[model samples]
Each structure stands twice: as C-alpha cells, then as structure tokens.
Target chain A: MNNVLVFPMIVPILAAMLLLFFRSNTAVQRWGSVGAMTVVFGTSVWILQQVMLHGILRLDFGEWLPPFGITFVADSFAMLLVTVSSLVTVLCLVYAAFAKDEKRESFFMYPFALLLAAGVNGSFLTGDLFNLFVCFEVMLLASYVLMTLGGEKKQLTEGIKYILINILSSWLFLLGIAYLYGTLGTLNMAHLSVRIAEAGQPPLLTTISMLFLVVFSLKAGLVLYFWLPGSYSTLPAAISALFAALLTKVGVYALFRTFTLLFYHEPSLTHKVIGYMAAATMIGGSIGALAHRDVRKIASYNVVIAIGFILVGLASFNIEAIQGSIYYLIHDILIKGLLFLLVGTIIHLTGKTRFDQESGLIANYPLFGWLFFIMILSLGGIPPFSGFAGKLFIGEGAIGAGHYGLTAIAFLSSLFVLYSLLRVFLIMFWGESSILSKNQIPLSKGMLAPLVALGIITTGLGLGMDYLSPYVSEAAHVLMNPDVYIEGALHNE
Target chain B: METIIILLVGVLVSTATYLLLSKNLIRVVLGTAILSHAIHLLLMTMGGLKMGSVPILGDQVDTYTDALPQALILTAIVISFAVTAFFLVLVYRTYQSTGSDNLYELKGPQDE
Candidate 1:
C-alpha cells in the first residue's frame, strides 16, 4: 500500500486547520495556504509518477482487507485529475491572495478554500461509495460557507436555493447507496463491480444506477442545472472561479467512475439516457448563453455547455471518447478557472456586469484583451489550443460509434460557444470607450499574473499533448477496461 | 419488523414532502430534517431487522446484525444535523437582510 496517496488530501486539510489559528493574520493565511497547496500539487504529481511506475496503487485504511475495508485507489485517471485540481487550487489561492478583498479574507477564506481542495482530493481518491458520499458533503459544506460568506442579500437568496437543492440531492444519493448496499451487500467499488458482474446486473440495479445518475446530474449541472447559473452568477470572482473549476467536475468524475467501472453492462439503457440528457443540456445551456446580456450569466452558461460536451464523450463510451474526455476535463478545469477570473476581472474593473455596459477596454488593457481573445479561441475549440484535440477526438469517437446526430450537435455546440464569447468580446472589449478616465481601474500585475499563468498552462497543455498522451491513454485504457481498475483495486487479478 | 419500518419510513417521507411543498422557509428546513430522519430509518431497515444479535462479539451465535448501516446512518445523522443548523442560520440571515421569509417573495433577484 502506497502512503503517498494520502498526502495530497492530508496536506491541505492540515494546512486548513493551521490557517484557522492565524485567521486574523492575512499574510500568514495567504502565503501559508499557497505553500500548502503547492505541496499538495507536488504530492499529487508524485502520486502520478508512482502510479505510472507501479501500476494502480491502493491504500486500505487500518490494514483491513478488500471488500471489508475502506480503500483509496490512485489510478492514472484519479491522479491526473488530482494533479490538475491541485494546480488549479494553488492558482486560485494566489488569485485570492492578491484580489485584496479584506472582508472576504477576514472571513477565513483560505481555510475554507483548502478544505474544499482536501474534500475534492478525497473524493477523487476514495474507492468506497460511502466515503465518496462523505467527501461530497465535506466539499458541499465548505462551499456553502464560501458561497454565502459575505451575507449579501443576493448571496443569501441564491445560496439558500443552492443549499436546499444540494441537500435534496445528497439525500437521494444516500438512498441510492442504501439500496445498493442492501442489494449487493457491499460498498467497496471493486467488490461491487465483481458482484454486479456475478449477478448479471438485474433490472433493480439499473434502476438504482438511475438514482445515482439523477443525483450526479444535479451536482454536475448536466440537465438539472436550473440552480447552477443563478448561484454562480452571484459569487465573487475568485470563489466563483474555484467553484466553476472544481465542483461540477467532481460530480462528472463520479459519473465517469460509476458508469465506466460499475454500470457498463446496461450501456443501451444508461448511456442512451446520458446521451439524451447531455443533448438537452447543451441545447438549453446554449439558449441561455445566447440569450443573456449579463456577462457572468453567459460565462456560467458556458460552463453548463462544457459539461454537456464532456459528458457526450462519456455517452459515446469508447476508448477514444474517454481519452478525449480526460484531455478535455483537464483543459476545461484550467480554462474555466481562467475564464471566470477574466470575466470577473472585467466586471470588477468596469463595475458593470452587462456586455453593453462597458467598451474600449482593449485601449486600456491590451494584454487583458489578448488573454481574453486566447480564452475565446481556446474555449471555441480552435486548432492549436487545449480545447481542440479533445473535441476532435470526441467527434471522431461519436462518428465511430455511429452517432452522427450527436457528432453534429457536439460540433454545433462549439460554434455556439464561439458565438457567445465573440459577442462578449466584440461588445465589451473592442467598441468605443465608455469609462471615464478617472473611473478606469488600472489592472494590477498581481491579479494579471495568475491569469497569465493559467493562459500559458492551457496553451502549454495543447502544445504539450505529446507528453500528456501516454498518461491520458493509460487513464482511458483503465476506464475503458474496468477489469484493470477492478483488479487493481481488489488485488485479485 | 422490516415491513413495519419500511411503512414508517414511507409515512415520514410523505409528511416531509408535504412540509417541503409549503412556501415558508422554516418549514422547508424542517422538511429536510424530517426527510433525513426518514432516510436514516430506511437505511437501517435496509440492513434487515432483528435477524441477529448485537454486532459485538459475545456468547456463541450463528449471526450478528450488520453494523455498517448503523455507522453510515450515524454519519448521515450528524451531517443532516449540521446542514439543518446551517440552513436555519441562512434562512434567518436571508430574512434579516431581505425582510421576507416567503419563498415567492425571495424568488427573484432582490439585490441585483
């Protein structure tokens, strides 16, 4: 059992608790949390390396044996996500550090952010279903506090809706777990896999899997995204960026894990349902993105659209599509973080939220304009950017799967993504000057540094696919072949 | 015994659903709490009822009750308690800030 898998989770949690003692000291909280996250990032990278060298690594708590003990499995898929998420958290913490929002800082933002990261890491690593539930709650509770920290009227109203909806979803999740445990008599994912295969996955199991789908859909914002755009539109940029980057991705990860590993026998039922839900989400999200004049709402809808696109890869359920999903998942995390940060920065600098409220920003912030232009291209799945390869592979997979209609919708959605962002770009950044000279808030270098860093990372990700392809392929192979994960997790090849 | 608990769970769930459908904020919070209670009971009943002795080792016995569901319910209970408390506080603050507890009144964007 490798000990390294735990550090990615432990470091941030320990740092969060330590940050609590220094809550009043913003300096300590800021740099300490960043330092802690960087360490987590390093540990995650190390975990990836170890997984590559030793195949899949599993850690059973208290030395308990399989199907009886809680396990933390670090496959290539989980570690790749952990590494990227840690990197995103580090950058978000840096952004939070320099944003200079003293009110937000004073409310223990650093601790909650770290706690959220820890919860995210835990969710990725867990091999037990119950532990996954617990991790989701940990992440949700931390997010609830972060979402409503300021107690503003808008934050509270939206936050209340967010919390209630999530509570209901979590309850559904528990009920699903209860039924699964009752039927299969196991919570360990690997053992559950073996048992389901043994039982030939009866109709009752398929119905239970549907419960998980609905529960995860609410969290992932797939089709049940009614609450997403509202709550996301109200948060501060850094917090919102973190949420946009990390939260839904966790739900998506859970979907990928369960569908690929546990519920593969009923693909015609489960995957077809996912395909339809994803198509509907893309249509609904595209309409919302196209209709909104509010910049944040547009960006939030863009998030929904991306979720649909990624799940399309899952719906195809081919190796190529899964690989594309992995590549795109990593790309989306970094790009969404950058996208929200830029959108937030635009709103912050202009003190306006609507596309028409401000103009001629490029004249003042040319660098910001270029970065945003790159963001638009990257998000639009333009060639030679991070979003391109994944979209291409997913499209190819859809075609290969004989899903011509889905392939068309997937590409069409990219066009919508481009159109929506271009609308924001043309009206908000390129038009005649709207802000008075005295009113223009000079873009700070500290704030711009994180955006530039993410921009470079996303660019590097696109250009550096040669290096990432092996890991991505390995991850896809494992996901496409659950026997690999089951054997790895249970040590019973 | 299992059938009885399942029936009880169904009753609790219906009562909680009714509470949740109302417009008041406090009722919604209470609904969530009762709903969680119903789930906990369902989880417990899922493990089978009175088929065996206590989970701990004792005199020779052919079987013992599954303790895992009990542990899971305990965790769920603590989490629900925390979430209910947090929801109450949030509702109070929303009321204080917006001067309304009615869901319909709080539906639209109040500050924006």
Candidate 2:
C-alpha cells in the first residue's frame, strides 16, 4: 500500500502530457524532458532508500487484495534498475537536445520518450504477469515511433522488421500468459510462484516456461537478436543509445524475474538451455563484432556481446552469479550508453560511418579520444573499472557452480570485446587525420558533457563498489530467495 | 464447441504463415493482422466455453463462465488493432518512398 512506488511510473506520464502542450517550442520540449527524467531519477533513488529501510513495498491499485487486483512491487532489484535507467535517460535527453532535427523535436519526441520511460518503470515495478505484458507494449509502441520518426528509407525498412518481430514476440507473450492463466487461474506473480511450487513444475509448465524464454530472449537480444543491429544502427545517436541502454535491459530484467521467481524447480531443463543460448550468443555476437567495419554495426554488435555476458551469470544460477548478473547489468547499461554516444559523436564529426573512411580523431579531439579509451578499458573488464567487478563475481560464481565451459567462454568473450574495441581504437584514433578541418563538424561541449558525465559515473561505480554492493547484494538476496518477495507481496494484508 | 474453435484457430494460423512467408509487404502486414485475430480466439477458448450463467453474480446462479479471458481478449484486440493500423501506415509510407512493395527490394545491406 505504499504510495511512492507509483511516482516513478506516474511522474513520467504527467511530464509527457505537460510536454505535449509545448510541442512547437523545442526549448521547452528538451529541457522539460530532461527535467522530468531528473525528477524520476530522484524519486527512484528515494524509493531505493525506502526499500533498504523498510524492505519490499507493493502498491495495490484501488486497495484490492493481491492475486485479484493489479500490483506494483518495489524490491531492491527493481528500484536499482529504475534509478539507473532514469539517470541514463536524463543523459540521453541531454544529448538529444543538441541533435538539430527540427521535425524530430516538434513531432512529440519528448512525450514519446517520456512514455517509453513510464513503460520501462512500470515493467520494473509491476507485480503481475499481464501487467508486465502491457508495460512491454507501452515501451514497444513508443520505440516503434522513435525508430521511424524521421521516415527515411533505411529507417523505414529496418523499422518494419523491428516492429514485426516485436509484434510476433508479443503475440507469443500473450499466448504464454493465456496458457499460464488457464492452468493456474491467476496472473499475480507471487501467487503463480506459490502455485508452481505446489504443482511441482510438471512437463507442461516447463514447456510454457520455454515459450516465455523465447519471447524474452528475442526481446533481450540473447540468441534471437537478428533485428537488433540493423534497427539500432538506423536511428539517430540519442534515440539509438536510449534503445541500446534501456530496451533489451527490460527484457533481461523480465528473464531474471521469471526464472528466479516462477520457474526455479527445473534448472536442469531450463537453466541448461539458457546456458547453451548464452554460449551461442557470446560466440555469435563476437563474430559479428569482429566481422563488421562500419562503426555503428560494430557498436551495435558490442551491445549483443554484453547481453550474452550478463546472462551467463543467470545461466549459472548461484548467489554470487546472480549478484554478478546484477552488477554486470548495471555496468553494461552505463558503458553501452557511453559507447554509443561516443560512436555517434564520432560519426557525427567525420560525416562517415565506416572506420576505413575516418582516422586520427585523437589529433583533433584529445578529450574525446581519452574518454573513448576509458570506455574501452571499462568495457573489457580491466581492473579499477566497472566491468571488472561484475566479471570477477560472475566468473567466481560460475567456477563455484562448476560450469567450467561457460566460465571459459565468458572470459574469452572479454578478450573478444577487448580485441574488437581496441581494433577500433588503434585504427580510428592513431592514423593521420582524414577529414579536413573545413569539412569536419566541430566537437561541441553539449555533446561531450553527457559522455564525460557517464565516464565519471562508470568509474565511480567501479571505485564506489563498497557503497553499491550492499544494495546489489540485497537485490541478489531477494532474487536468490524468492520467499522474501512472495511473503511481502501476498501477505501484505 | 471448444474443439471447433481450436480447429478454426489452426486454420487461421496456417493461413497467416502462408501469407507471412510471401515477399510482398502488404501480404506480410495482413498476415500479422490475421495472426493476431487467431491468437485472440485461442485466448478466449483457453478460458472454458460457456460453463453456466452470465458473469454477473447473483444468488440464483450456480455457476458462471469465466470472464477474465474475455477482458484479456478485449484488451488484446484493441492493442493488435492499434499496432496493425500503425503497421499499415508504415507499409504505405515505405511504398510511397521506395516505389516498391516487395520485401526483396527492402532487403538491407547484410541481406545483400
């Protein structure tokens, strides 16, 4: 019955409505969106504090009891993501303001972005399965608009593929929910957990879980990631970064929630399948990243690789592994956002998309070069960076769980990340300048501010682990032990 | 009655699959539309067929048909409707700009 859980989802809707009135004024649109996101960020942090102090919080609509009415539960895991996503969205909005697309600005971009945020927040906080489906649609619908906002030919083609694939996956989602409801006769996640445990996860239940796996895997870009690179590479830098940072993550979050809470009885069947998919995703994404010469393609493939790495922890299914998954999830969101912003800025400056066509960016933008190098190191899991801690914990957990092959493949993929990104660095930064000064777009402070902010934040996340770990461990504790969540959600009366 | 509905759903699904595999964009869009309708029917049938009286409760009623699936299908129908509308608009715009409705022409760089 706590009230604050609604703020993260509701505030964004209110802000979107506020932004709609000022559509013609780009200044209001830009700052208003940023201001709204900042508010969400603050609200999420406060919610995190509340969860830490009071334990899990659930908001039942209209005071109806759980297992009957809709619910939004704020546990430590969801609030952590909600907070980080809101912060990253703020930075993305700051970057979008500098994008001089008049039509994009006036065409409800701010409102749609806010709606997307609202949907994402709702997905995180939702306590029921059907509510989660609705949240996914809210996010996907906004994303379709964002993807095709400009109506360019390339965007149109890729947008069609993206929308179609998502629609199909969403259909599958509905089918899964319908079957589950037919069997359990309840959509509340907590009640479903109880029922599945009582039913002992029969063969039929496991099959249904597989359907959910495929649905979420497509959304998360795990193995069914075919639509990602092309669709993502076509959008403007800011929107693309937002999609890269936030969209797949919600899918991953759903995977974490369902597998940990609803379908834990048969790890041999379900988690084993996830392990194979994670391995394949790693190998495939690495191959794609190494194969591409276009900077956007390279960056997009890097996103796939990160998705694989995070899920390896999930496949392992140990406490340390879950904690590592959480840690790595946060790191990936921040670093990927930073990585895309850097790649986009580079493409913007050189007016070229491929690495072969541009060189010696360091000679012109030393700060940008160094920041990119930091991003590379952070991404590759070097010591004293955000990526390192998560990889360490996940590796340790995988080894503890005796998943030797998965551990080896996971670490090797880090090498792939290092090699692919370093190749981009050595070639793109070290050579003689290709574009003349007269032709190059000046690197603006407005663009660089967001990157610099993300750079420091990722570093801070690494060094400030002593503070963040308590929350991460708390999240992992609830994830590892679903009883805590179930008790809180179902016994609130 | 339930078996008949399920058979109808299968027929619709086969039709959708055929249309989806075509290279024309309009057929693909229509395939998705029909596919959604098929799913909506399946969802409704999953909740039992008419078990008893109206869902509205009364002292006289001994049993009532499950109404949750009806609510779910209603929501699903509206959503699929909105998405189909948007997808149709996108296909039209793609045709207007590219001068072709063939998925072969819409293939991206990797496909080539």
Candidate 3:
C-alpha cells in the first residue's frame, strides 16, 4: 500500500504549498514546477504498476470506515486517467517554459499548474460525491488563474465568461449533491450506488441524475459548448491545449463514473438521452470546427467532438461500448495533447495562429511540419495511429451493441474531423513557400522534446493496444459489476 | 413552511439568472452571488427543515435541526465567498482594461 498511488495527489499539493514561500526566485519556481511534475509522473507509473498487480487499491482516509468520511479509490480506470493527466502536464509544463511570457510567469503559473494536477487526481480518486465537487472547484479555481494569467485583454474578457459558467456549474453541482444526499442519505459513491440500486428508479434519483448530467455536460463541452471555443482560444497555446485535453475529460470521467455505477438502472431513459446528446455534440462541434480558421478554436471544437464520442460510449452502457470509450479517452488525451503542442509550436514560430495570415511552414521547418502532419492525421483517426485505434474500438463497440446507426454516425464524424484537419494542413504546411518567411525565433529543445516524445507515445499507443486491451476490459468489468465496489465501500469497517 | 422557503429560493434563483443574463459585468457577478446564496438555502431546506433550536449539545435538546446540511452549507458558503472575491477582482481588472462595465463592449476582434 505504501506505493505510488498516493503520491500523485500528495506531491502536487506539497509542491504548491512549497511554491507559496519562494516568491523572489523565478528559477526556483521553474525548477520546482519541473521537479513536482516529474515526481507526479513517476508516482503515476508506480500506481499503474500497483493496479496491474493488485487489481485495484482503495484507501479510506485515516482508516475511518467508508460511507461516512471521504475515501480515495483507485481502480484500473482512475489510474489510467491519472497516468494520462500527469503525462500531459509534464509535456505542457515543458512547452510552457518556452511559450509563456514574464507576465504569465508572475501569476504563480507553476503552482496553479500543480494545483490543476492535484484537482484532476483528486477528482479521479475521490469516492465521495461532495469530495468530487471540491475537486472540481480546485480545478476551476486554478483554471481561472491560468486563463487570466497574462492579463491579456482577450484573456480577461473570455476568462470572465469561463469563470461564470464554471461557477454556475459548481453551484448546480452542490445543489445536485444536496439532492442526492437527501435521497440516499450518503455521499460515498459506492454506497450510494447500492442504495440507488436497491431503491430502484425514484423521481428524486432521476432529478439528481439529470442534474449531474447538466453540470458535467457543461464541463465536458457538450451541445452547449460555445463558451469553450471563445475562451479556450484566448489563452496561451500550452494552457489552451492542456485545458482542451484534460479538463473536459474530467467531466466525461464523472459521467462515466456516475451512470455506470450509481445510475445504471434507467438505461433506456438516461443512456438514450446521453446517446442523442452525443450525436448532437458531434455534429455541432464538427460544423463549428469547419467554420473556424484559427488553430486553437479548431482544436477546441475537436475536443467537443471527442466528448460526443465518449458520451456515446457511456450511453451505450454495454461492456464493449464502455471499454471503447475508455480506450478512446486515453487515446484522445495523448493525441490531442500532441496536436495542441504542435499547434503551440507553430504559433510560437510563425507569430500567428490563423491559416490566412501564415502559410508554407513545411518548406522551412521540415521536422515540425512532418510532426504536425502525423499529429493531425492521428487526430483525424487515420489508420496506424492511436486516434484510428480509438475510433475503431468505439465503432466496434457501437456495432457490437447493435447500434449500427450510432456506429455509422461515429464513422461519419471521424470523416468530418479528417476534413477539418486536412483543411488546416493544406493551408498551413503544404503550399508554396512564398506567403511567409521561415520563423526566425529558434525553437527551444525543452519544448521540442515533449512534442517528439508525445509523437512517439501516440504511435506506440496504436502499436501496443494489445497490451492495454486487457486492462481496459478489466476496467469495463469493474464498472459493469457494482457488487465489488459496493462491498468495498460498505464492508471496509 | 417548506413551500414558503422553496418559493423564496425559486425567486432568488430566477432573479439571479436574470441578472446574469444582463449586459453589465458587475450585475452578472452580483447574480452569481445571489444564486449561490439561494443554492445554500435550498440545500439547507432540502435536508427537510425542522422547527427546532440550535444544533448544540445541551439539556432539553429534543428538536435539533439537521446538522449535516448546515455543516455542508457552511463549507459551501465559505467557498462561494472566496470565489466571489476572486471574481470581483477579476471584474475590476477587466473593467479597468476595457474602460467599461458592459460585457457586450468587451467582445474582441473575433466577434466582429
């Protein structure tokens, strides 16, 4: 039990607290951020190992019995998410080293980044509903700071909108928790699931479930995801990418956790609702992406599309569908992180993010151009890429569940994503080298290293799906069978 | 008694939502504040309100209130306060930069 599972949550908070004391030294801040993120990565690997060995690790706080106090539980699913989030954070921090200006550096960017890490970890690990709300707040607070760090005119304006929407969501989350607490008389997720199952489909249960969906949908950038494109595009590229990659995934993760565990009985109503919403989100996001010329906005819309796919998986509620969603989530995080990093690098180099303002990057920076090509293609779900593998799995899951129509929609949405990405690639990289000069600013090795690393990781994920399949399948099993979770929560006396 | 509190909470929520949809940024912030207060009250009321004395350890404490929801509300109230304070500062900065409190005016080049 004295393993890496605990460190991912601990190291970040510790690092943030330590950072509060060192206000005078920028070098200390920089190194502290790097060191903290590295520790988190190492711990994530250790926790992954422990999950691989012990199946799942449940840690009750202070040895207190569950269904009373807060609990931090780690199954294969949560560990997988933590691993992905930590890996993405490390890469984003590396990129931020080169990309962020002095103004951004001043706002405790490193500490806030670590705080975001802690929040994601906590959200993934916590066994209590109210604890999840607190984690969401932690994440939102850090995100507000990160979004407004540079004090850019656009950042502040859009940051206000982002802040307002999220705060409202948090309030709704609290209200929902209150309602759930009133109905179930418990906040522990595992225990709540049992009570919910025994109680069957009550009106109060449905109301709370709908509330949960609304709050998480706002976070996940579902059909009502206009705020994302506007606000996400206003931040620094690294920040935007990180937010685009991980934050919404937290919402999706919550949906998966709740629907599969606590609200599993009303599949016809709840799952179907999610499925329809997912369909709308996919079509809406793809249309929005096609309308945008800015790389960041396009990426943000793509995130919405990915969220749609995840919702479909969860909505399906079948083993294959859930497993596919899980696999796609991991794939989306890595590939999307790489795409954002590449786009950030491009903007950093060319001093512009719009396709019309800049053109012909491939002729000058062949390495970056090719890497961006791979990332974009992988994002478009091309074969032999991680994105393709994820889509294939989700498609297979949909079809296996006899949802052939949903499978078709998923395939069509993939094509839409492909079209949008190809538009950017053609306009930005594959033209005559006359519209814009080669970028004069030298790319930092620290920034380039993570992008290269992510590129390899994305391909490796595609190549190594066989090794990951068993773990993902096991996660699906754990999710489908609530008995173990209920027993663990209730019998931990 | 429950109906009265629910109606009052409902009014507060509607007022807050209306204010949030207004043009002024400050009004929006105020709306959020009001809405959070309403949510806290709703949480308190949802745990099934009781006609009782303060939840304290004392003699003749026959009718004690639901301490759980109250505790949860207190925590939420503090968090909402912190977030409100943060939002105010951010709005101040935003107003200073834009030289106006109207959100519509703050729309950037992309909006045009």
Candidate 4:
C-alpha cells in the first residue's frame, strides 16, 4: 500500500493534538514538537528516497479511486519540498525553544506550529486542488494564531492587514477553483491537467490561470510583496524564520505546480506574465530593501528579492532554469533562516533592532559577525556558497532565453542585496561598540546549534553541489513533464 | 434563473469592491465576507443551477444534481466562515488596542 504517503501530514496533526493535551507544559510541548518534526522529517526523507528510486507514488483516500476521491501524491518535487519543510520546522522549533517568546509559547505556539507544518505538508502532497484550498486554510489559520499570538499593539495592527489580504486572496483562489471545476468537471489536479489539454487552452482557461497567478502571487509575496517586510519584522524571530523559509515558498510551490502541470499549453502567454511579475518583484524588492534601516526589515526585503530570483528562473521555462530555481530555492531557504536567526541574535544582544543607535556588534560577538559575513556572501551569490550555483544556472538560462535585460537586473539586484546586508554589517559590527544592553539575554548552545547547522548546510550545498545538482536536474525533468505526475497520481487501482 | 444569479454575483462583487475601497476596518471585513459569499454563489451557479432529483445512484436518478459542487461549496463556506470569524476577532482586537476602527490610524506610528 502507498499509505505511507500521508504520514508526513498525519504525524504533525497527531503531534499537534498531543501538544494540546500538555498546553501549559512548555517542556512537553517543545519536546513533543521536536519529536514530531523528527518523525515527519524522517518520513519525508524516506518518501523522497522512495519517490526518487520508484518514481511518483500515490495514495488514494477512502479507496474512491483517483478522480473521485481524495488523493495524496508524493512526486519528486512535492517530497523534496516536504523534506526541507520538515527540516525547517524542526530547526525552527529548536530555535523557538531558546527564543523565549514566552507569552506566545504559553498560548500554545508549539501546537500552532505543528498545525502549520501539517497544513503546509498537506498542501504540497495533496493531488486535489480543492484539498489544496482546505490545506491552505489550515495553514493560514495556524499562521493567524502564530502571527498574532503575542497580541501586542504592533502585532494586532500588522496581523489584521496580513489576515484581511490573505483572506481576500483565499476567496480569489476559491473562485479560480470553482471556475476550473465548472469547466473541467473535476477537482483532481491530474484530472484537471488532462481536461485542460483536451480543451485546448480556452479563453476561460486563461481567465482561470490569471486568477490562480494572482492568488499564488499574493501568497508568494511577489508583485504585492509590500505586506511581507512590515508584517515579518513585527514578529518574533523563530516564527519569522519559519515564515520566510516556508510560507511563501508554499505559494511558489503551488505556482510551480499549477503553471507547469495545468497551464503550460499557453506558456507564451502564461509564462510571460510570470516573467514580468518576476522582474517587477525583483526591482521592487531591492528598492524595498534599501528603503529600510532595521536589520530584520532589510533582510525581510531580501526575502522578496530572492522570490524574484526564483520566479525569474521559473519564468525562463527551461530545464536549466527550473533546475536553477529548485536548487536556489533550497539554498535561499537555509540562508534566510540563518539570516533571521543571526538578526535575532543581534536583537537579543543589543535589545534594539534598528541600526540607528546600535553599533560595533562584532566587537562584542565576533563569531556572529563572521557567520553573517558568510551568509551575506552566500546570499549575494558569491561562489562556493549555496546561492552561487542557482544564480549561475539562472543567469546562463536567462541568457539562453534572450532575456538579457532581466539577466542584468538579476545581477544588479544581487549587488544591491550585497550592499544592503553589508551596510547593516558595517553599522552593527564595525562601528563604535557600546556596552551591552542591561536586559541582554545570553545565547544558548541549543540555539547556536541551529544557526551553525544551517550555516553548514548552506555552505555544504555549494561545496557539495555535485550531489544536489543531479537531484535538482531530476526534479526539474520530472516537474517539467506533466505526464509522469498525471500517470502516477491517476494510477489504476 | 441563471441570468439573475449571474447578475446578482456581479452586484455582489461590485458591492464588495466598493466596500473594500474604504479605510474602515469593519468595512474591509464586510467586503471580504460579501466577496467570499459571491464566490461561493458563483461556484454554485457555474456548476449549473438545475432543478433535479436527489443525487443518488439509483435507476430513477437520471436527472439528479451534481453533488460535487455542493461538496465544494460546503468546504468553501466553512473556510470563509472561519475566515470571517477570525476577521471580526482581529477587528475587535484592533479596535480594543486603538480606540478606532480606521485603517488610516493603524497605518503607522505617525498616524497616532
């Protein structure tokens, strides 16, 4: 039985439920979540191994057959994403335990985090579009709780905007699903692909595709990425790390799926729109990054810029482009997670996030300065770090696609990211050292472990890229070809 | 019947859009609610507004309705209801912290 496919989602839901029972016990909740994520991470890695060796795997729920009942499909792409997501969740849980966001933790941060993981894993793995919507709701609901858990005046204002906008986007997503179902008579993604191909990409198809583009773009923080920095900066660090790494990436994953799997017939139209938005998001993101003085806010804009880079690769629509995007995506997530952790450390030491009054951080904590230097190099696409491979691939691929101007923007934006990060570095680490804040919380080994571990993984991805390259190539090949996903998901009983 | 529903959806969407343009927090929540309702109804109408028998697999069920859209609508409704409830709570919380529901005030510290 392929029932193993659902374990990635099930384990987390079960973990969250277990966590609810020990709501007041932070130790139990923390250990329980870490244990749960470890299991989920193991399952995801195993599922990924099986998927790679055996090709796409499918699990039909209620045995209602493929098109009629719910289905969970673990293709190479979905499994890969789930693996990273689980890894990120586990790391974030560890970071959060040491993070001391006590008020939020008391209000069940662990349970909500588990639920968020479950929702994300479900969305990535499920083969049904409607089920994807439900999973999004589950994910967003958990996010609502997590984002507003502290209930500060700052949190409430920003959280309200986050919720309202996402709610509107959710409704748009629903409308798109309705249109697709109305047109195709099925909600299964594999079935939709088949029907869309049969229908020869109608005008209605274009309309529906546009709606989906908007929905996923909003989630991915692409064209409308303005909401991202403000909201993220206002959150606690661990949650921001999780958000930066996973949440919008979910949108990007959904974008990759819908664009490649269903809406590929008119790539000239659809992919071009994607390309334009990628460009806009690129220019917009760098400008936004330069607009901020706070370290977290600046890095938050880097999140937007990285999304643009990945989207450009997707829009290029070549094997190399997809490969680069996939590779860079994993790279970007680890790097951003590390960046947030480092920023969190800075905030912990200085008791202020704004760079105006903070200076000479490295004089106090020299280790973090060097670590941030490595992260900045990695993020700036310097060689022998994780970001280099993807940027190279995408650059070459964009050149191949005759997107010369966009390629220039890509390089230009990377420089801006480099400059902005270095600006923060110069102000915080190199300037006059002030006495440590009176309320400074000492950093813990457990917390430092995740940051160091993430830093190593990110570096290893670059130095050991030969190992990751083949997998990214394979994943890109599988994703670009919809037949494999369709055949696997709709496999006969 | 179908035309009326389509027109009604149009009206609902227009009204939602209009309400959404305002800066009031409550209006924004109302806009989202109405918009979700419109989408749900649009889904129903698109699935086909047919007068038919119960959707059962009987020999007598030749003219039965499509159950899939109904199931889809139920899911959408539940999600939107959750969203709406969350929106109200958020609005209430926002109101409690700042004595006004105007989004302009929450725009920044400068506004306060």
Model 1, range A1-493, lDDT digits (tens) per residue? Answer: 3877889888888999998999789999999999999999998898898899889999988889788989899999999999999999999889888887899898899899999999999999999999999999999999999999998888899999999999999999999999999999999999999999999889999999999999999999999999999999998889999999999999999999999988989999999999999899899999999999889999999999999999999999998988999989999999999999999999889889989877899888899999999999999988788998899889888788878888888889889999999999998889888776787788889999999999999899889989999999999999998899988999842
CAPRI quality level assigned to candidate 2 from its DockQ score = medium
What residue runs in model 3 are displaced by over 4 Å at the alpha carbon? A2-5, A435-439, B50-65, B108-112
Model 4: how far is A415 from its true place, Å? 0.8
For model 3 chain A, the run of ten residues with the poorest summed lDDT:
A434-443
DockQ of each: 0.85, 0.75, 0.70, 0.79
Tell me what TM-score chain B of candidate 3 gets against the true chain B. Answer: 0.86
lDDT (Cα, 0-100) at A474 in candidate 4? 73
Which DockQ value does candidate 1 get?
A: 0.85
Across residues A78-164, which tens digit of lDDT does each residue of candidate 3 receive?
888998889988888877876656666776888998998899889998888988988888888898899898788888888988999
The DockQ assigned to candidate 2 is 0.75
- TM-score, ranked from best to worst: 1, 2, 4, 3
**All candidates' TM-scores?**
0.98, 0.98, 0.95, 0.97
Question: Model 4, residue A472: what's the lDDT?
Answer: 82
> Which scores higher on TM-score, 1 or 3?
1
- A1-493 in candidate 4: lDDT tens per residue? 5898889889889889888988788999888899999999998888888878888888989888989999999888888889888888899899998776777888999999999999999999999999999999999999998999888898898998888889989999998988888788898999999999999898889888999999999999988896898788877889988888889999999999999999999988999899899999989999988987888889899999999999898788888888889888888878888888888778876778777777777766676678899999999999899999999999988888878888898889999999999988888789777766554455678778888888888888889999876668778988889887888889644
Pairs that collide in candidate 1 are none
Superposition-based RMSD of candidate 4 using all C-alpha atoms, in angstroms: 1.6
Per candidate, chain B TM-score?
Answer: 0.93, 0.95, 0.86, 0.91
Taking the tens digit of each residue's C-alpha lDDT, what string does model 1 give over B1-112?
Answer: 8988999999999999999999999999999999999999999888887678987888798799899899999999999999999999999999999999999988957434
Q: List the residue pairs that clash in candidate 3.
A: none
- Evaluate residue A208 in candidate 4 and report its C-alpha lDDT on the 0 to 100 scale: 89
Interface RMSD for model 3 amounts to 1.2
